[model samples]
Target: MAIHPPAQEALTPPAPPAPDRLTGRARLVLLVLCAAQFMVSLDFSVLNVALPVLGDDLGLSRSGLQWAITAFALPSGGFLLLFGRIADLYGRRRMFLAGLAVFGAASLLATLAWNPAAFLTGRALQGLGAAVIVPTGMSLLTTTFPEGPLRDRALGISGTLLSLGFTVGMVAGGTLTDTLGWRSTMGLLTVAAVAVLATAPALLTESRTPDRPRLDIPGAATVTGGLLALIYALSTAAEHGFGRGDVQIALVLGVALLIAFAVVESRARTPLVSLPMLRRRTVAFGNLGGLLTFSMMTTVVFVLTLYLQEVLDLSAFGTGLVFGVQGLASVVAGVYAPKVIGRIGARRTLSFSLLGQGLFIAALLGLGADSGVWLATAAVSLASVCHLGAIIAYGLTVTSGVPNEEQGLATGLVTTTQQVGLTVGIPLLGVIATADSSLYDGVRTVVAVAAALLIVAAGVVATGLRTVSSPAGAETSPAAAKPSLAAAESSPAAAKSSPSGD
Candidate 1:
């Protein structure tokens, strides 16, 4: 027989379409992905305004029924890494769609729920879906948009959408609860999820590791369990005393389980959290600084919220308008983060952002009950700008230099710290504020403490992120870790091919 090339060897993938060629479809994909993020972010607060109604309808007390929030937060905050890694190993598109379905189904369950038990079940399921969607959506976004301006813009938009979601959720919750019913809040989510599910399969492309490794069941279990314990402890600590027995037990056990997870990750052939990845300065200290930054920013809002409503006697609408300044500032900062990063570099942006945040907090120390709203408004807006900058910069720093196969893990870590930050921030600082004789006095104390914390966080960013070397493959090129959507369309097999050409 005549010599012939193997049939399999002759097979070839279609040429990858370049990033610039698919601008229309690219924008569609970005829109769909951001919508999902908005949905996930909205779920975090949409139910807050409905809580009293829910409590009354379910015949429960404030304390007795509060688990609805906890149930959602616990899983959403906990399972981000596990789900993100799963998306990378299996398929990002698959996980994203499944999450949408789960979230929608859970919203339906809550809408029809007749009792607390049913509602709680739905909330927890929603959290699970939120956890899955966020990291996966982020991974998809980064991978879809090539590095540099394209990638930066995508992240900036994502940050903006996420901030808008939080504010919109709280506002929508009250409006819907007042006009419709508590179930209307969930009904809104169900409708949104259904819409996302219907369109995503077409707008997004599927991509996974070429040689997907076997799932790390132990790492998944330990991390998920540990995060659950930690989230619950922090959540309860916010309401109950931190010294409460359950908090102490959960804290200790959570730490132990996490330690065990670290050990497992260190030894695993294919770890869920690659040890080498964490060794990167941007990944390690960046996340730590992110944690501190998020906590301080959130705590500031929490204290000021109490001061405005309880002491200053601002109405709910007035409070909303006041917070509107912060929201607007956040939007502006997030929109500009990409350009800022382009000009100043991610490390500098992060460091300066943290430093700015500390100064803003210090300025808040000068405000008193009688201080004009403009002073409070200006301080809050400026502080919010800094907070948004850090959030975006830290995200870029961590995701830089990672590979496509690991972007899921990278984004997962970024989001996990966010959830952890939100969970711990208010409670930790609320204790200090409440300990004082008066609320505004405690507000001043909170400002001092938050300023100190932000200063420390700035140091961390300077030392851990700014000072780190640009080790080869350590976020050297965005395309390495983030493949373009066109590339994913042409060849799923090329997902892990080369870092040089995105």
Candidate 2:
């Protein structure tokens, strides 16, 4: 009689909630995700002001101190593609939480570091965590918000938070370094990471998929090693002369490895990067434009920071306060940029913004060591606005052109390019700037060159813009495109997912 009852059990059906629908809980989840994004972006620039203090406390030389920054940047930039794919194959929310955990742990380790090597290791782990967080955050946001005004608003807000995070970090870093010492900066990051981790389980929802691709181990190692080598070589050249044998050797090896990576991607059944995506006009031009734009921005910041400190003789606090004007300008510009793009269209808006950025950067050349404080600040402020507008517009274009499935890969590629540009910009431009007698004179030269680069980047976008029209005669530029797509194929996810759908 009991054996008959054992055969009667029925399987329960799974939950029926629509994945595309944005529920109240979905909005809350998105907010938490965006907060995490803000925190990660903030940490990138936050450490800039605290570097000197950290160096002194840890007995790090100038070269060693620079490694502290590079450690975070190198992993984040190089491993972006690898991590973005991991999120897609695994789960965006799961990967994001894992990243936050790693980030928190690394920050804790950094806070306790008694030597340069330990601190660098911690920074590298933090970078690895960031590599997971950034693209995954965008992917989750895209999944939660369907394409339209809501998605645009969310993306715009994310953009604003990115700039705001950097501002807050710089301000907080300086204040903390001055008051509590540099170690507190890492502690602060840890606190933020913990908050993110705690909120994630409740606010974040996981996406279910029937298939998971195998890890692209070779692709991961090749890209990571290649980028690290390239950046390391460039950074070393910045410190020591470019003529050094070690720098040359690293550069050669990096180029060779990257070439091999390209070959591997073409043959692999499950390639890490989607080579075909690189052939898309939108992806190629937008990414190249982003690279140039970010490089110019990073170089400008580097030169201005030095000019303020060395030439203007401003203290760290004073520099932060002064640079706050740029941040404010960027925030304002970033907030309004979407509206502006909506009205004028992406190509025109991008052209105008890039031209403005170039003019503003070139304008900096007119300022001398004896120039008035207001004049210098005003120049930087104007450049900041232009830079902010260009970045927002460029970001929109880059994310909008690709199909939803490729958004994550696209985003990763763009982000990686931007990071590479930034990593190389300082050294490349700094060398040119310092080739002259006076530091002020060198800065002027660098600004002029950066302005030229912006102009060229603008030209690239202008050329690409003519080709991005929809069948309806309306532009499908980043601003106009709707964000509707499934979890795996969503636009936001495409921003940093694997180039291959796998």
Candidate 1's C-alpha lDDT? Answer: 0.84
Per residue, candidate 1 scores C-alpha lDDT tens digits across 1-502 of: 9986655433444454434333888889999999999998899889988999989998767775668889999999999999999999999999999999999999999999988889899999999999999999999998888656677778888888887788788788989999999999999999999999999998899987767899999999999999999999989888877889999999999999999999999999989998878887788877977898888887887888788888788888887788777888888988787788777777888888899989988988877786556677789889888888888778888887666878899999999999999889888888888778998899999899999988877876687654432322123433334555644655645554434335
Report the error of model 1 at residue 224, Å.
Answer: 1.0
lDDT of 1 at 265: 93
**Worst lDDT 10-window in candidate 2:** 6-15
Error of 1 at 97 (Å): 0.3
For all the candidates, what are their Cα RMSDs to the real structure? 5.8, 8.7
TM-score against native, each model = 0.89, 0.86
* Candidate 2 local Cα displacement, residue 165, angstroms: 2.1
**lDDT (Cα, 0-100) at 309 in candidate 2:** 84
